[model samples]
Target: MSQLATRPPLILTLRMDSQSQEFFNAFRKTYFPPERNYLDAHLTLFHHLNDNDQTLATVKSIAQPAFTLKTTGMKFLGAGVAFAIESKELHNIRKELAIQLHEQLIPQDKQGYRPHITIQNKVSPEAAKQLLNELQSTFQPITITARGLDLWQYLGGPWKHHAYHALGPAPG
Candidate 1:
């Protein structure tokens, strides 16, 4: 059995600017199905990682230099929808961690990363489509800098936030 099967699987997220975070979160609260919405708007780096010393060590070791993130507009998620993200630097960070994790990563984390912030999910297909169109019609390119990385423990329904790994060169 995989380590994820034994312990709480860890999730990695890119910390967004406070303003943007507030906006997206409010957008989610307004649109997302209230009964199913459990977490705030976030950009997930790794969906599932095994919790261990190495995982925490590598996370804390990273000095995430702030990087520009662009929104490529909306994407249809069949029964849901999300704002697509574009960031080569973010992908590189994920790649670097993937290399370090090797076989320790969960199968889901092993796949290619398609970074996005889901604002609505598990709603009727028509509802999702309507929102996607509405958002896309009004969509303006948003450029924001990611401040750091966040590690979380997935608790069946709600998540337990662990720590935020600030980016940039560590002070000597």
Candidate 2:
């Protein structure tokens, strides 16, 4: 069998700037259940994409420059919380990629995209609600930079690094 055919599915995530990554990752580590935290803080673009040449080519063809996305507020996930992101440029980039790799997208990826970085998950509802209320009390909007897209090979509980498709230089 071909390597691509036997390989695990790919997950695409927005690559945040170092500062932003650290900030979010800190929150993730402090709040997310250690037993269930298999990955760092991330904003997923696609939950699952086929691991194949076509999917790789489509990601490589994206020519957008690094851009800033605003963190509008917090999203209550019943059992967790995430910071909501807002960016027209990010949306457009995903739309273009979606068109190009429509055939490789799973049903979840085919749905509308609501960009977010999950900081905490897999906790009880009460714990989640208390954290949500605490965080929301002093929440202020912040802008974060998106530098690229990272592809990962899902390994059941953890992910293996696959590749990174860097975006062009940020516009001044």
Candidate 3:
């Protein structure tokens, strides 16, 4: 196999700006101090596309204009913590994009469609519940706009500082 063939293809994602960044930073410090080096703020679209070139082309063709995303609630996934979006439109957009990418360019697993931005990973179940309780007590809704989509790669480290490339604007 060729070099390109050996590597997994990933879809682009959009990143959060300064204010959101600051909020996440503070949240991390308060609730997840151990998760250091986490840098870029983003939401993932697709990963491991079978054909990257085709996928990119297809993505560009269907991408929508940028829009706002409001953070409405919080949840925990095993040891992971994340904030949820208030807008159903945002959720639907993500799901639809994922579906489009999977159906057209590559096949995706059915169970991979949960919409969330992970804050931390690898915690005990009890700790996760405690963290959730703490978050619920201190929770405040944050609204943010989605400017674009980005393509990220796994650089073999903690998720906080993963290297990423912006693909393009999202389709409306």
Candidate 4:
């Protein structure tokens, strides 16, 4: 069987509104190393979930309304940089999912949720620090809309879109 035929781990992320997505993507494209930038900007909720029908069903069961979150600050990630986000609603949603997929949660996923959208990674620490400083110099908190949950199949470095369940609507 081909490698892809076997189930791969799943990734869950929040889908942002178009404007917010574009804003993040722009920064990601401009700052991230071109060769290593496989996916667009994302706020990962669950880093890894079992790739199975049960997991899919649980994800499909989530019903959340569109909500807003704010980017409060820039986080320097040693070798990368991210925009820190704050939202009670986002936390609640992930907590609920964590409960449902408790056994399947990996250590990283089980760790405390610190929501952030990484725009630059795989660079030197010095570079990351410089970018962090540049961004923070004129940083203004941005309010962005979270529109839905998006499920993806992890394909090594790159990912393949699996499904998207819009907030404020029954799972279709």
Candidate 5:
């Protein structure tokens, strides 16, 4: 079998609303190192899932409802900065997935799951901190609707689009 066929495509992320997308997109473009900027801004859900039917099955079973993630604040990530997010429901879904994929979960995936959208990465600490300060100064409470679950194949740095499942419907 070919190497590509044997390797399970990994990397799943959460899809967000359009407004939040525009905001994060602008920030990422302006702050994130130009060289490392490849894909659009996104919030990750599960990272590094073993490529298999089981993985899809587990995702299909998630009952987590669509919700909004309030942008808590900006976090300094040593070499990057991210907009912290808080979503208990989303976390629970990820937790459930972890349990289902426990045996085959990779080391990194085994660690605690933190939901955040990185606006800047692979930059100097000074650069990160400066941007954090700038963001904090003008930061306002932004609610991004966690619309759906998106699946992707990790292509080293950039991710290739794969599949998406939107939540059924928001309670009336």
Candidate 6:
């Protein structure tokens, strides 16, 4: 198999809503300049699909009509910013889906499993501390409903807004 065929695919996700999109865009703008805003707005559900056909088939097999996921609070990962999922159902569902993928399709990595959405990167230790302080003072809990799933490709290039492709509804 070719190298690209050997590598796994990525599942990009988000709480498909105007507020979520706007928030992501604003957050990116604040942290990353236009030139650096290569990564499109998304919350990743899982990564490293072993086989695209098998992965897609599995997803399709478990497909649901539709479902909503909500984000409830703000979290700080050093200098990285993220919102937490409030709904137990949403959290459980995402975890279950990831576990299923890991067990059935992809092998686990050394990193183990931890779910998060990265809002920004590139912070000095001092800057991270400052940002954390600011987050404590200024961050407010926000909620958003997720509605879609995307199958994305990392084209061996700088992160760009066009790297994602909609893969239809998420399997609820």
Top-scoring candidate (TM-score)? 2
Locate the minimum summed-lDDT window of 10 residues in model 3.
158-167
Tell how far residue 72 is off in model 2, in angstroms. Answer: 0.5
> What are the per-residue Cα lDDT tens digits for candidate 1 across 1-172?
9765688888999998898899789988998899989899999888887788888898888756777899999999888889899989898898888888777777778878889989989988998999999998999888867889999999887899987788884235
lDDT of 3 by residue, 1-172 (tens): 7887775445455566667777776766565536553544356555444445655555555445556677767788787677766556556656776666656444453454555566655777788788888887988887776654555454454332223333246565
Q: Any runs in candidate 3 off by more than 4 Å, and if so which?
A: 33-39, 103-109, 158-172
Q: Each model's TM-score, in the order given?
A: 0.91, 0.96, 0.74, 0.94, 0.93, 0.70
Give the per-residue lDDT of model 4 (tens digit) for 1-172. Answer: 9564488899999999999999999999999999999899999999988888778888889878788999999999999999999999999999999999999999999999999999999999999999999999989999998888899999899999998888883234
Q: Rate the local accuracy (lDDT) of all candidates.
A: 0.86, 0.92, 0.60, 0.92, 0.84, 0.55
Between 2 and 3, whose TM-score is larger?
A: 2
For model 1, name the residue pairs that clash. 63-168, 64-167, 64-168
Q: What is the C-alpha RMSD of each candidate to the true structure, in Å?
A: 2.9, 1.0, 4.1, 3.1, 1.7, 4.3
* Top-down TM-score ranking: 2, 4, 5, 1, 3, 6
Q: Write the per-residue lDDT of candidate 6 for residues 5-26, one digit (tens) a residue.
A: 6654554454467777887777
RMSD of 3: 4.1
After TM-score superposition, the amount by which residue 66's alpha carbon in candidate 5 deviates from its true location, in angstroms, is 1.5
Preferred candidate (TM-score higher): 2 or 5: 2
Model 4 ranges with Cα > 4 A deviation: 1-5, 169-172
Local accuracy of candidate 2 as per-residue lDDT tens digits, 61-163:
9989999999999999989999999999999999998999888788999998999999989889999999999999999988999999999999887999899
Worst 10 residues of 4 by lDDT: 163-172
Q: What C-alpha lDDT, on a 0 to 100 scale, does residue 98 get in candidate 2? A: 91
User: Candidate 2: where is the Cα deviation over 4 Å?
Assistant: none
Model 2: lDDT of residue 63: 89
Count clashes in each candidate, considering only residues at least 3 apart in sequence or on different chains.
3, 0, 14, 0, 0, 3
Poorest lDDT segment (10 consecutive residues) of candidate 6: 158-167
